[model samples]
Every structure is written in structure tokens, then in C-alpha cells.
Target: MSGHSKWHNIQAKKGKIDAKRGKIFTKLGKEIAVAVKTGGANPDGNSKLRDCIAKAKAANMPMDTITKAIKKGSGDMEGVTYEEIMYEGYGPAGVAMLVNVLTDNRNRSASDVRCLFDRNGGNLGANGCVSWMFQRKGQIVIQRQDGMDEDELMMKVLELGAEDFAAEEEVFVITTSQEDFSSVREALEKENFEFESAELTMIPDNTVSLSMEDAERVQKLVDKIEDNDDVQNVWHNAEFPEDFEE
Candidate 1:
């Protein structure tokens, strides 16, 4: 696994959960609404909605909140229309960064995002600038359990159409082509596999090795961006030292 992945796993394990839960729910709600608006309110008939519901459930979002979001998105209730946007940039040490956001006000989101980058020793760039340094793919993570057989799990994921699989110290990561993501996830779900995370993400082609200082700076930038209401996800290419303190 890359340093970015390791850092992500560590964050998942140790980040402040209670303080961030509300923000997480807000983001998931937006995703659910967008998914319903684009596809439909039915998860069975709408893969995007299905994925959103899965994500919401993983976050432990209440069923009523999920239902309300779907209703609002399907025009059964009042809600603001949101537009999806992607911002590309370079963080400290020339680390390529990608920000994904869904917002009702594009100008506000753009300004907020640009300000975050600027204040954090980075700058937002043109759309294709840093995007070219990354590839779109589906990533799924499952925690490593005591009773699990690594080889058997790898075979299962491969059989279900995953492109690659890696067994990290604390988790199993599976990669799939963007088009294959939903099917692969569905297959895994049918077999009763639980996930730490399952999402379509931007994977960097290569990473920039950063010193401790640079890594801290880049991570702070990432945290600020992620804390924004409209920002749903942030992808970066910085590779910190394995033993670097969080």
C-alpha cells in the first residue's frame, strides 16, 4: 500500500469520531440526495443510490434521515439543487491534490476551496492540471480479521471482478475498474462481506515523498479542505514516512 493509503487507514482508526459525525452525516445526505436526483429514489433500480445508501448505512446514519434525503431529491419534498464540482491543485512539496464537492452555490464553494488551498501553502490549478496525475478507480477496504484467510479472500475478490487486491497490516484493499465497481461491490455484499469503505476514488499515478514538516503541512491542508461543508472527498499524492507521527 502507498503512504497515502496507510495514512488513511490510520486516520480511520484514530480520528475523532464524535466531533466529525455530524459533518459526515451531512456529506452522506448530500450524496444520497444527488444520487436520487440523478438516478431515482429506488436503490434496486439505481446503482448510484444503492451505493449512497450503503455508504450512509456504513456511517450509521438514521433510516429516517436517509429517507428524507431521498424524498427531497425525488421532488417529493423541498430541497436545494446541488452541482458536483472537482477542483485540482498542488499541495506542499508539489503533491497533487483533487477536491470533490457538491454544492448549491458554486461561487461560494469555489471561493472557500481556493481560500483553503491558498492559506495552506497551496494553490488551486486549472481543471486538468493535477487530474492528469491521477486515475479514477473503485477502491474497497475491509479490516483484517483474525479468522480470515488472506489468500482465500483475495481469490474471492478476484473472482468477483476486482482488478487487484492487497493485504495490508490492518486491512485488505481491493481495486476495480470504475465501470466494475458496483458489480464487484454487490457481489461482495451478496457473500456477506463487510467493508471499511467502498467508493470511487482518484488514485495518484505516483507519489511525492515528503519530509515530516512537508507532510504535516500537506495533511493540514487536506484536513481544512475536508472540513468544508461542500467538500465530499480529497485525494492527494503525498507519501509520508511510514513511521511519521500523525
Candidate 2:
């Protein structure tokens, strides 16, 4: 699996969670709303919307709530306008981090993010600071133990334009360049290959190994940044110890 999947699995095993449920919903809701706004509400016609809906379903969000979010985005209902933002920085041990956000109040979000970094042993940097260390890609995590042969699966995805494939923690992860993401996903779907998760995310080029103390500090910054009302995603280069939870 890709590094993203490893972190996700780690989070799952930890069984603990995000800042506040309400705030978490806000971040997710904005994603759905934005997707609908950008590409009409029809999932069949909007791949991004489809992905957002899938995540909403995975989170156990109600259908009515999802519909309401779409309506808000389509201007059928009034709501705060959300602006997408990205902040890059270095955490403890010089771990590179990127935080994606959607917020109506840019000033408030910026200050809160800056303070979070400062308080957590990190320092926010200029726009291009840590961004060059990452690449945007589409990733899919498949449960490898469900009768799927690794070599066969690798060949199949490779034919669909996947750049690389690997196995980790009993899961097979497929990666594709951003341009080929939709095509690759569709190919897999046509083959009836089931994926545990599919997402377009930032993947670090290389990881930074850290002492436990520094790792915890970086994680603390990550949690704080992600907790902000505007933040949508947090990515970092810190490699968690195999046994680290959450």
C-alpha cells in the first residue's frame, strides 16, 4: 500500500478520532458542496462528486444530509462560501507537511493554522516551501487477501496506466498520475476489482524517519491543523514506527 493507506490503517487500528464530529462534518460537507457546485449534482457526470459522495457514505453520513449539501452548493440554499487554501510547513525533525483547507474566513483560518504550527513545534513557511516535496496522485487500496493474486493484479492495473503497484499490510495499493486517475479507476471497475478506498491525494516523495519524541510532536501539529474548521486534509513526510497507533 502507499504511505497514505498505511497512515489510514494506523488511524483505523488506533480507534481514536478527529477533533469534533461537528467540525469534521463541516469539512466533509464543504467537499460535497464544492463538488456539486463545480460539476452539477449528477454523480454519473461528475467523477469528483462521485468520490466525495463515496467518502460521505463511508463516514456514514445520511442521504438527506448529503442532498442538503449539494443543494447548498447549487445555490438552492444559502450558506457560507468556502475558499480552498493550502499551507505548507516543516514540523519537528524537519518533517515536510501540507495542509489543505476550505474556509469562508481566510484570516481566521490562517491565524489559527499559524498558531497551531507554532504551538506544536512546527513553523509555517511560504507557499512553495514544502510543496515541491510532494506529488498529487490518485491511489486505490485493495484488500489483497480476498482471493486476489498479486502478480495478476499488478499486470491488470499496469495495463490501465498505473505508474506503480505494491503490497503492504495485506493490502494492494495502485497509484496513477493525476491525468490517468479516472481512466485507471474505470478500468478497474470494468474488471470488477473491488477497492477499499480511492482518493486523489498528496503523496510524499520521500519520508523522514524520526525519534518517537519528534514523531509525536509532528503528529500533534497534524492533529491541530486538521482540527481547524477550514482544514480538509493534512499530509506529512514523517514515517510512523510500524507499531505506532493513531
RMSD of each: 2.3, 2.8
Could you tally the backbone clashes for each prediction?
0, 1
Residue by residue across 124-168, what tens digits does model 2's lDDT show?
999999999899998776666666788888888898899888777
After the best TM-score superposition of candidate 2, give how far the Cα of residue 22 lies from its true spot, in angstroms: 5.9
Among the numbered candidates, top TM-score falls to 1
TM-score of each: 0.91, 0.87
Which pairs clash in the backbone of model 2?
A: 1-168
How many angstroms is residue 7 displaced in model 1 relative to the true structure, after the best TM-score fit?
6.1
Per-model lDDT: 0.82, 0.77
**In model 1, which regions exceed 4 Å deviation?**
1-4, 7-19, 76-79
- Model 2: lowest-lDDT 10 consecutive positions: 10-19
lDDT of 1 by residue, 94-119 (tens): 99999999988999999999999999
The lDDT, on a scale of 0 to 1, for candidate 1 is: 0.82
